[model samples]
Target: MAGIYIHIPFCKQACLYCNFHFSTNKKLIPQLVNAIAKEAFLRQDYLTETIETIYFGGGTPSILPTSDIVFLIDEIKKIFEVNSNTEITLEANPDDIDEANLVAWKKAGINRFSLGIQSFIDAELQWMNRSHNAKQAKHCIDLIKKYFTNYSIDLIFGSQLLSNEDWLVNIKTALSFNPPHLSCYALTIEEKTVLGNKVSKKVISNIDNEKQAQQFNILMKELAIAGFHHYEISNYAQPNFESKHNSSYWQSKHYLGLGPSAHSFNGSTRSWNIANNALYIQSIENNNLQIETEELTTTQQLNEYIMIALRTSGGINLNIIEERFGVTILLELKNKITAWLQANHIEQKNNFIQLTNLGKLYADGIAADLFF
Candidate 1:
């Protein structure tokens, strides 16, 4: 099944660790929403299969008027073949969620939510420069629990202000709500962000790799005990609540992304839109798509597959690799993973090779080592 990702390139405030393409100016929001709708129609023929999921992501989709969100969904439905059970997800921040907004979002056909509640500690929220305070975060969760069942909330571990006890408290707080899905991410300072600048200037302490690793381990252990499945390296879900849209990406399914700085992928080629909001809107209005495309080489595709698949709980499918590449390539892979297998970093079960907890610590490094 295909998927659609609509990037809302505007936020009410910028978080310290965020580097996503967004404008704080609310004046252009109306134009931006219209531009996004236009882009959806422009790229309607991009996907061949029926759309099973539509994700409204970044800078803060919940900040938009409910009417604008419904307008975009209606536009997409008119132009594309959307499935009856399509998973429509809107990424929301705690501050934007109120009873009225939740009711409006539900009316707008938002069946799922991805809440950005980075931390439960007020100090941690301040450190991250997140818009919402701790109290508002909890209050929103309470409101959401009353209205929605299919939702996921995000938590950032390994922040300078968070201790292990604080991390446990944060996870426990989320567990107290019995959320269906959780996306726990280790904070990594990306370039061009305020956090990155702080690191460069020694204005703030750098991320301690050991501390991050410890927190990751803590997250995995806590979630597993709480009966959450570690479906992906960064995502955990209870039972069948795993995000279909994100899982499609990990499985390399075709998806069309609409909006500035959004990326689209089919079977062989990938493309991305221009990051500038004004330029993106201008180009769409002018009926000239501002995007770049690239064709993936066999090696590039294989490496990409290895990178994504290895991060998942299903691991790498040897038979699929053998069929797509060759038995010779598969044998080489088996040989390459021998050291890791011996070290118990990875384990082979039937045709699937999955990572062990020890291996997960070095998942990226191991995937790179096995890359073509």
Candidate 2:
């Protein structure tokens, strides 16, 4: 029903395309881990429901020692009610995956892994400045498969380095490993990232939208042919293998986020920890966790739901909308979606208005059109 997200804000190296809140300072690891555990205990009442998932995300969670990982999980269990079969996931990069670490992680209560194997091509991996090589990427999957059954691979498409043929090779290589789930994201250039800077200075070209769209289509078709469900816009999974933690966000389930730059959501409000690691640790150690909070208006919540629900295969549930926001609002939503329905971008399934495969390409634009 709910989840907990712990942000580990340290990485072995900085990737060229990343703009996330993280540090190359490994010295902060011990302090940050202890601070995160304390933060979890302090915010124990944020989610009232039983915890279905616990996700360790960040710059790279696998950078932690196995003992630290165990201590954190034990700390969380002491303060919260975790599900017996909870999906405790650690986001890892391939370079950090070795037999010893994998064995230790399994014993440390990490039942799932979301591997950051962005590409299986050495050239592309180098282009992204990834810490792992293509060989490590393949080897890690084989290692993880020996331990966890409910694991996911993270892949990136729409890179200028990836041609349609190269994208197919990446997909096929991942599928060959039979990972239960795959999350394929389009490479977005943020102004603060190294790649973004290059583009700003005209040192390199940006991603071509037409090429990106073509690769996405190829991704969908290939995944579907391989019997993976297009459950969310960026996610594909075999049956019953969808990510529980990420799904909770789309379903608007309450969760507690710990550590720097992590965000938490209750039904009506959103709060986020400060992005600066030093400041976050300092504040938490002082027994005052600093975060910016915002209370959502009814219209804001409705629009948020519209945006999230439309991206999902379940689409918008007319019944839930009516129940929560009133019948009048639901009727207006229906009226707003009439054009999309007529254009065959979206279709109705009983009370659900979901995107057609074609509509998935324009998911954001369509969701904006239906916004309150």
Candidate 3:
């Protein structure tokens, strides 16, 4: 099955650590939405299969008025063949969520939410320059429970300000809310972000890998004990609560992405729209979209497959590799896996190779090592 991703490239404020393509300027919101809808029709045949998921991710989709949100969804439905039981998700910030907005969002056909409740601590919020405070973070969860049952909350761990105690509180607080899904990420300071600048200037310390590893271990142990499935490296969910759209991505399903800075992948090629808002809108206004694409080579595809599959709970399926890429590649992969298995970094059972707790900490390195 296929999926659709609509990028809403507007936010009320910029977070200190965010490097996403978004503008704090709300004046371009209408044009951006219209541009995305137009792009949908332009790329209508990109995915030949029926659409199974529609994800509204962005600077903050919840920042949009209910009418704008509805218009986007309606436009998508008109242009694409969406299944009746399609998973429609919106990414929202805590400050933008309220009873009225939550009710309106639900009514507008959004079945899932990925709330940006980065932390349940006021200090951490301040450090990140988040628009919402701790109280709003907590209150928004309450409102979400009242409106939508299938929701996920995002939490950031391993910030310099977040001690182990604070990290525990953040995890426990999310558990207290009983969200169906949780996506906890270790904070990384990207090169162009404000957090990165601070690190370069020594105003704030860089991320301590050791502390981050500790926090990740805590997440695994606690979430496992709490009955949450560690479905992906950065995601946890209750039974049957896995994110269909994201899972489609990890499984290398085709999807059409509409809007500036959005990426689309068919089985063999990858395309991405331009990142500039005004340029994207202007080009689409002229009935053209500035995009770049690359066709994957056999080796590139195999390496990508190994990287993505290794990060998931299902791990790498050797049989699929043998069938698709041939026995030679499969034998090469098996020989490499032998090293990790001997090091206690990977466990093999039932023809699947999955990361151990120590392996998860070095997932990227291991995936890179296994790359062809």
**RMSD values, in order shown:** 0.8, 1.0, 0.8
Clashing pairs in 2: none
TM-score of each: 0.99, 0.98, 0.99
lDDT tens per residue, model 2, 219-275: 999999999999999999899999999999999999889999999998889999999
**Candidates 1 and 3: which is better by lDDT?**
1
- Runs off by more than 4 Å, candidate 1: none
Q: Which parts of model 3 have CA positions greater than 4 angstroms off?
A: none
What is the C-alpha local distance difference test score of each model?
0.93, 0.93, 0.92
The clash numbers for all candidates, in the given order, read 0, 0, 0
Global local distance difference test of model 1: 0.93
Which window of 10 residues has the lowest lDDT sum in candidate 3? 98-107
For model 2, the local distance difference test gives: 0.93
